[model samples]
Target: MASTSTSATSKDSPEPSPDVRVWLGNRQAVEEVTDHERLAAMTDTELAQQGEPKVRRAIPMKKACTFLNIPGGTPLLEGVGTVVKAWPHMSDASAPAWVASTSGAYASLLAEHFGGVEVREPEDPDVMHGPYTTDTAAVAGETKGKG
Candidate 1:
């Protein structure tokens, strides 16, 4: 004969972990992103009243690299990645926009780091969902290629 017992353990229940908590907290600290102009058009003061920034600051490539863990051999080279500048009042309104750029072999690598959104062409101000802002990142400073 075999004996069996079943019981519910407190640990088995789904609970929010600290990482989830921290991510949510960070997300909240920034403005709510959207493609709706009517919503984004709210003034900076208005956004502040709502407890958010009209335009969220960009996330740096270095930080993004650490988050994604791509090797240097990748097209991104080293400092090749995007900085996302949140639009004020949803600049496009009907579309999301970000301006990202890089100088190195890895335009694709930069694109990959940013969830594979197509790299936008220069001379286009309306970047719908791409990296934004500029920083002087160079190849030499990047860590040697590694997975």
Candidate 2:
């Protein structure tokens, strides 16, 4: 009778090492990775020599909005000025606000509209007061807010 053994290592062959797959455009290759340090030390050329084309993943707007902590479809206030200075509890403890508008009339209008007082100077000099909304009627082929 004859005896036989099943083994990965044979007298004529050696064992294979672990490898990592990387991507370079349309080509694919395999690379033997000794360890994480060696893999991290590999150059772009070396990585590309043994990599496959990578697939990109896209995130939906709803998922992205959830991740960003902002509600979807919220219009950004473009022309709103940043708070250069804040006067909190100057007159009343309950009312706290910032001096953001430069124009006195505009500031008065804003105060009347939003129930806030207008200050002589903005806490921030860089902030400006203006009408910032786009004319949707004009965009839709109607003459609105376009004089």
Query: What overall lDDT goes with each candidate model?
Result: 0.28, 0.24
Model 2: per-residue lDDT, tens digit, 1-147?
Answer: 111121123456554311111000101111222355555777889778965333222222211100001111111221111110111101112322332322343344334434564333443332222111111121111122211
- Pairs clashing within candidate 2: 22-51, 22-52, 29-50, 29-51, 84-123, 84-124, 85-123
Once superposed on the true structure, which residue ranges of model 2 sit more than 4 Å away at CA?
A: 1-96, 118-120, 123-147
* C-alpha-based local distance difference test score of model 2: 0.24
**TM-score for each model:** 0.25, 0.19
- Candidate 1, residues 31-62, lDDT tens digits: the string is 23343564567787876677542334334332
Worst 10 residues of 1 by lDDT: 18-27
The TM-score leader among the candidates is 1
Any runs in candidate 1 off by more than 4 Å, and if so which?
A: 1-76, 81-104, 127-147
Backbone clash tally (model 2):
7
In angstroms, the error of model 1 at 106 is 3.9
User: How close to the true structure is residue 96 of candidate 2, measured as C-alpha lDDT?
Assistant: 22
